[model samples]
Target: MNIQKMKELIDKLSQASRAYYDEDKPIMSDKQYDALYDELAALENSTGIIMAGSPTQKVQGSVSEAFEKVRHSEPMLSAQKTKDVNEVVSFAGGREVNVSWKLDGLTLVLIYDGGTLQKALTRGNGEFGEDVTANARMISNIPLTIPYKERVELRGECLISWKAFDEVNTDGEYSAARNLAAGSIRQLDPMVTKSRKLSFIPFKLISPARTTKSEDLKWLASLGFDVVENINAASNLKEVIKQFAPEKYDYPVDGVIIEYNDNQYARSLGTTGHHPNSIIALKWADETYETQLTGIELNPTRTGMVSLKAVFKGVDAGGAILTKATLHNVDYMKNLQLGVGDTITVYRANMVIPAIDDNLTRSDTYELPKTCPCCGEPLEIRLAETAHFLWCTNKECPAKQVRKFSYFVSRPAMNILGLSDKILEKFLSLGLIKDFSDIYELSMHKDQIVSLDGFGEKSYLKLIDAIEKSKDVEFSHFITSMAIPNVGTSSAKTIAAHFSTYEDFRNAAVNDDFDFTELTDFGGTVADNIYNWFADKKNVEEFDKVKSHVNIIYPEKKQTNANFEGKTVVVTGKLVNFTRDGITKELENMGAKVSGSVSKKTSFLIVGADAGSKLKKAEELGIPVISEEAFKNMI
Candidate 1:
């Protein structure tokens, strides 16, 4: 082995590892990194010369200047992960083990003393971590006080749910749930952590050890900790794999964890520098289905970015027929050498999202589009930090306005029922609607609308009624419906909560009297977006027109009720006495925040018949549950 080549590999791998584990960006694919790591390990073994900086020889830690560093009492080791089920089965040796989701988020260690939470630390390397106690305290699922009086410690994952992730990720700045969760947790302001709605699910009890893993999890739940859901006891790895379905989970999960039930026996098995021998992670095999790429479709987004979608022959993947997958950006397409008529292998990432795994036939013959498909204007390639994307150069592109209008009437926004994107496209083509205000005036074209292919007398009447009903909208909904750049439902809610009324907010924005940057999680970018949107004459005119036809109801001042004060409640399934919105509003009026998922902070989970994962999670977390009748009686 050449020493110089070995040294170069070490440096390259180290840099990539740091980028992946620390910065939440992978410079190379997992397969590429693993192959290079294997080569480096083999060279070291053959030459009997291990370089000091070799990734195999030591553990690397990330550095963040914002937080104070603290040493961990026990090392937090990574699990040995494998894509092969055979290896997992061989390691298990037919022993009964607990199978649970390997949550794709930041690892956190919590310490409790005298029945009160003491500290929370990130899993920085293994020996030390940055102190994140303040941010941890803001996590909805972290318990400030536990029932156990003795000093105890726990380890878990801090994660964001897909719903909350989507609500705040309007700008598409973060790519994955794990990346968003990591970034949210590392914020200098704890208010950012609170707004992100982070949750902690304990997987391990570090201190006051129990005999079995099941017992430990139960104990953790008893102490008011949200525990990871235990699927079932599996005697073999095959059973574990069969039971591991990531789609059913509310939170994002990268893989499944199979750990020995006997805690003492597993601990005795000992550790490596990187991972312990007791547990192994079973990652989803990249089972790729080959399909021929038919073509690529570029769709203009509300932000003027033309998103590329690959049209491919239909293939079954993860129980779904996938005909199209997002190409992500120009760089991704170029790297894959993707082209029309190429044989591409497609798979479902995490058994949910369809993705292109590889292009077997690197047919680089496909030409990139030089003009915007919608506007007939020349396209511009814009460079982001590490990627390049095609953007529509036309500022007044009709496709952009259509996308924005679609988003404005989306469920999270104004929620104009019975108006589908296809219908909107038709209306746009007919010049019946151009802006959001045109939606209210849609009744004027009722005769024309009813004459359309899908629209009839009944459907047109229903749409008109929905439009009328939507005029009495909440302040947050109105704000979200404006389609301000980078401003989504969550940020709109924050703004509504601060200003209380639409008039107050508008006055402050128009006069430039208030600094939006002072709001929690509202940085300079968000402030600029809000200011610029309000400053635009066209936007102001459109907003004024919409406001004239709508009644923006400000949120009521919450009443301090002993039953629900300062409580976080989650409602699941169908309600009998109250509609979903009604019950949520009632809870909010009583000084409770309604959350979608169950956690330790969830004071009550109102479950109904046909309840789903939230009920199961509430039970696992040992949260108090109530029926609709019981909830009504309490109120």
Candidate 2:
């Protein structure tokens, strides 16, 4: 309660906040920080002594004057957090409570007037924020216009989905999704924001707070806002923890937020300089599994980058069996001093992906592979952004070709079902399939294919049928399946939109007349990649052969349909009423743009049984997911 102690607490908390928010690193756990904050607040209250720089007295944020600053109507204080489940139960106090994921992203405030979005700002220093209205408008899920005409202010988290982070991070520049989201929203150019696919999930209504917290979230959803997902009347802390299993959620959630359902009672308790007493954050303790590293596997990707994977003793982590973890690149390997026969500790990052937490024995004996596994070509180290990776310098390495072919038949590319990588490898070994065009000619080897191990008559017939069905592909699908460097599904869609027909695109690429950099995210590198890919005589000839057997359906001219115009949609799992292509065509017909992955811009996720990562990602982003029957009804 003394002024000296208050100053100490203030300095410590401020340092932690700066590291967590600005540096994307944490010096203290959420629990440790919250406990210290609470002690500081209690001391100030009891002794009637508050330091000028106390964390509780003001919002904890650094002001970046790069953008215009806007003062917040009300201070956006941090939430009190705890590691103990007992504290959460005590905080709930037998009252109905809503427990939701504490999304690890940058905080944003949105202002609306006359049912139209007016302004958007970052939670800079709590009292004021940097104006990012232009960038906010570009986010797909942040509704430009809501049903309510009255002036309203909302608080939310601006985040990049894990799926989006991986796609946009083609060069592996960013370390985490939160960091990517932070940097993306702060970009001065709104075009950058659009390219990154940042999304906003509103968690609190700052103005006209007339309804209970639970009711408010429902009303927000009704008004076309993507409200944060939560479970109402969660019985206990254990129940909330069960629901918030890290592996089940697609986005990065550091903890869980538990708040009283009754908004009035929560407000009555008041708040300190740091956090409100009404709500608390429960941070899950990371569970680590110790295992011995047996060996390392170098896996070549489509881009010729060889990723080092740690092969260790199998560990059951959070119900999933994990025996291998990604070493990322050479830099990570050197940092860990990884070696065979070394003891290592592994844990699921966010309870999902297996990650090596620590190497207890820094044996430092693991040697980097000198040659590519598939083609025995000499490997070279390349520096990309901040990381160093092992790459196959040989452009014609069979390993790279195999990965490229595998990607070509992936769901996001050609949607060629039943052609597993093992099957592709077999076909390649037998010289039955040489290039993209050879996939279509697979039917010619039906007798040979059926005679192969694991290839029965029924499976062979099914593979042929799938390949034949894939022949009727769209321009975007065909372009994406080509495995052009730096060109993904989104970029392919953009290219397809600009050049309606395959012939037009090919001609433009050949002549280098079109300005591809003018597209949303396309740059000189992408343009160069496109031109170079087409300029190769072999590629051109192979593409011509592939183009002969398939029908390329050019994109339809933009049609203004009220139902789903300007909407971005993702279809995942299985559908009863529509095939993947059929639903995609239907969505396109209704003016919806179909995306291969789920992102913040995704308006709706059409999900069915056994929905995978996309469905979980949709739930995390609070994007509306419609069932097959519901989709039929809407159409």
Candidate 3:
């Protein structure tokens, strides 16, 4: 063995791992990656030398700087993977094993205390992880509180379904469910995660040692978790795989995980440097088929970066026939040596995202378009810190403005009713909406809008009414309408409550020496975003223009609860009279800090139906518990 190829494989795999985990981007197919990995394993065995920082030795992924990193109580290790069903059967060796979908999304370790969800962490390199507690709370399927008390730790995949992916990714922004799910769950703002409709499906119980993995799943499900679907592999790997196959799942699953059913036996088997000995992943490589590339499609994004997509002859992947696959960047396209009419292999990563595996023809004949397809403007090559991407520098590109217009009409923003992305696109194409301010002037094109498909006189009138109604939006809504990065409804409301008016908010960002980071939960990056957005001439002009059209109504804070001022309150359980957001806003308005968990600092705990652990904790801590009606009376 040269060992030179071994070193080279390590480097290549390391790079690919970084791209996939740190960047949330995959540069190669699962099959190709696995083959390289297996080859690396063979080389390592032959040479008896595992290089430092080798992908084989350690669990991959970088801890996000946006989150607080914490060491796990027990290391969340990786698993030994194989594509062969016989290998899985051999691993089983007649002993019962639990087979489940190896979900292709971000893994989270959720910690519960006193029957209430307390914390959640991402599997960052297994030994340590990022704190994603707030974001985890937003997952739709995960219960806030469960029946079983005592401290417990559960491991699960935080995912967005293909259906939810379709709903959220209106502009083809994300190519796959895993990509969107990971991105959404790792968001700094939980509201963003909430909007995406992520679900946490528990695959393993990390705490309170049970009889078997199957027992753990049953217990977790009883505790209100959407447990991962599983079946008993009782000396029958083939039958087990059939139930846990790629085509059988709704969410993304790259493979099936088989773990020993006997907990004590599995524990005795012990773990390797990177994975456990008792568990293995039968990697179901995405269905690959040969196809011919037809052409490349380019889409310009709000950030000015252009996305390159390869259109190929339709081929069946996992069951669905997909023709288009994202090239990611020009570097990827060039690496594949992809050209028009070139014979290429296509497969869907995670059984949903169509991706090119390799170029069979090796034509290397494709040329970068001289101009952006959308704007017909010369494309600029942006030199990023690590990579280069094509940019459409044209500021007035319709593709760029579509995002802004969509944001402007969103419910939390302008509250403009009946305006969808498709309708906005139609408006952009017809030149009815050029800028944010033009949304207010939509009444001018009423006759034209009425004539468009799916538009009747009643619908046009309703739209016009909405546009007129939006002019009377509150200051918070107006601020949210700007679509500044990381500035969602809550942050915007904070800014609005401080500034009191659109003019004051605008001036603070540009004209005055104002520190947005001084606000509650507002970080330095958010402050910088406000400053940088204001610095832009186009942003300033558009903001002011839109501001002129809208009546900036600052909500009057009717503070009836004088004693509640500066108090720390925690609201728990389901309330019929008010939603969580409603109660939180009300508390905040009365100068109280609304904490998520019950603590010694908590001055009051508002109890609702199924108050659960928080109420119990409050009682134990001697914290005051009040009924919803009692809190309402205080309000």
Please write out the lDDT profile of model 1 over residues 193-248, one tens digit for every residue.
77677889999888898998989998887776768987546565586578667887
Using TM-score as the yardstick, the better of models 1 and 3 is: 1
lDDT of 3 by residue, 1-635 (tens): 55788888988888777666666665665667787999988888888888887778889887878899999999888999987888889889999999888998899999999989988999988888999998888675677887778999989999877766765665565656777888888887665676676878889998896899999987776565667878887866688687665654668888889999999999999987889999999876566799999998988877788878999889876568888988766656677887799999887775556788888999998888878776788898765433457788898787777776877788778989889877988999999988889988888888899899999899999998888988898788888888887777777877887876777788888874988878966766678888998999889999889878878889786574786889988899899999998988788878888876565557899999988877976786678999999987876
For model 1, state the Cα shift of residue 67 in Å: 5.9
What TM-score does candidate 1 reach? 0.82
- Candidates 1 and 2 compared by lDDT, better number: 1
Alpha carbon deviation, residue 500, candidate 3 (Å): 11
Pitting candidate 2 against candidate 3, the one with the higher TM-score is 3
Candidate 2 local lDDT, 422-476, one digit each (tens): 7887898788988899999888898899999998999999999999998888899
Collision count for each candidate, in order: 0, 2, 0
